[model samples]
Target: MIITGEDIGKKFGKTWIFRNQNFEIQSGEITSITGKNGSGKSTLLQIIAGYLTPSQGTIYANGDQIDEQKHHSVFIGPYTEVIEEFTLKEFLNFHQQFKKPVCSIEEMANSASLPLDKMIGDFSTGMKQRTKLITAFFFENDAIFMDEPTSNLDDEGFQWWKDLLKKIDQRLVIIASNDQEEIKCCSKQLNL
Candidate 1:
């Protein structure tokens, strides 16, 4: 699979996030988008995920142009990662209701070390992020776009995330973060 962004640019009022930003991300590999806050890290990701219309340019995921109205991309941005107050089981049920899979949630949870009995509202931020990532691993999508993936992860959890990315197949993992460790682990870098 191939994800190509050519001369991608975005603007909010007079604030131009970035212009002529380009990248060609390949399948079965991880790529990091690095930049400071307000430098368009999240904006660039949102544009790729088809959440926002770019002020310029276009993108193609797996050789097809992304449709902004459709939920083709698995967008795991910070604001939409998870819902509050749902128990882990309930959350899993909600997530699976949209996509049927070969393995059960229990199997996925066990493999990812996610808790099933705890309330998400009571879980730590890192745990919450892990739960989201675990859901992403099971989601039905060709690509996964993660914004600040290591934001809430602890050292161990971060390592788990790193190792897990190395094993996924057929899916493109595009991460937006400033984390050095994550950047090092990725095969390519999309510097914003």
Candidate 2:
């Protein structure tokens, strides 16, 4: 997949979140979107993922214009929406059931380090994050978006992210993070 944008901008009231940003993310390489607090990093990712639209300019995914209602990219989803009521296994199962090019049940469990029988309702926040990561990774889409991946992780968990960063394929990842370390792992970067 190839994502390209030019002169993209957004605003709320008088606060200009972003303006005139240009970028392109391609398959077979990992791209990181980085910036400081209030720099519109999350909003930019949401736009690229087709959840929100930029006020001006254009965004193309795979050479086609992004239509929010028809675009099918997968996101790890905001932390707020992760299912706290479901077991980790159950959650993965539910996601796989609806996702296109879904993976087998066993593959989903292993991809996210989820113990197929474990109760996700009782998992620690880090564990939950891990499960979310797995779900994002297991999805079959060419474009995958994640925001603030290290929000609740510890030092060791951060290191794990760094390690994983090197291994992520460019053909499949777009990470939006404020952490310099995480952004460094990206083969290329787009700053807003």
Candidate 3:
């Protein structure tokens, strides 16, 4: 898939978070969005993921206008929340009703080193981040948007994240982060 944007701009009331932005993201490649804090990096990613609308621009995917409800995309970020009431296995099962996972629940749990029976609410920050990454990466989606993906990761988790990044092929993966390791794995970059 190819996602293209022209003159993308976003405003909150009287203030403009970003304006007159243009870019493209294609399948089978990873694109990193980088900028300092409060620079609209997350807002841009949200707009691309169809969660937010641009103030004065157009975004299209494969020549068709993009819509959040219709597009098969997932966003992983520091604010992305997990089901606190569900165990790891249950959460995976619940997610299966919406999208097919890239692997079995057991496999995902094993890969993330998560205990299947543990509730998501009890997991540590690193574990929660790992869970989010596993869920986002293992979904069969056309687009994946991530913001500050390595916020709560440890050294081992960083390695796992890097390894997972290498496996992201044939999908439109856009990441918004300042982490050098994450940016280094991307084939292209856009600075806000």
Q: Which candidate number has the best TM-score?
A: 3
Give candidate 3 misplaced runs (Cα > 4 Å).
none
Candidates 1 and 3: which is better by lDDT?
3
How well is each residue in 44-141 modelled by candidate 1, as lDDT tens digits? 88888778888999987766787733443477755774776888888888877886553687887776677888888888888888888876777676
lDDT of each: 0.79, 0.74, 0.90
Q: Is candidate 2 or candidate 3 better by TM-score?
A: 3
Would you list the clashing residue pairs of candidate 3? 28-170
Give the clashing pairs for model 1.
none
State residue 155's C-alpha deviation in candidate 1, in Å: 1.7
TM-scores of the candidates in the order shown: 0.89, 0.85, 0.96
Per-residue lDDT of 92 in model 2: 71
lDDT assessment of candidate 2: 0.74
Which model is ahead, 1 or 2, in terms of TM-score? 1
For model 1, the run of ten residues with the poorest summed lDDT: 68-77
| Per-residue C-alpha lDDT of model 2 across residues 2-71, encoded as one tens digit per residue | 7889799999888889999998777887888888889988889888888888888899877778883354
Better of 1 and 3 by TM-score: 3
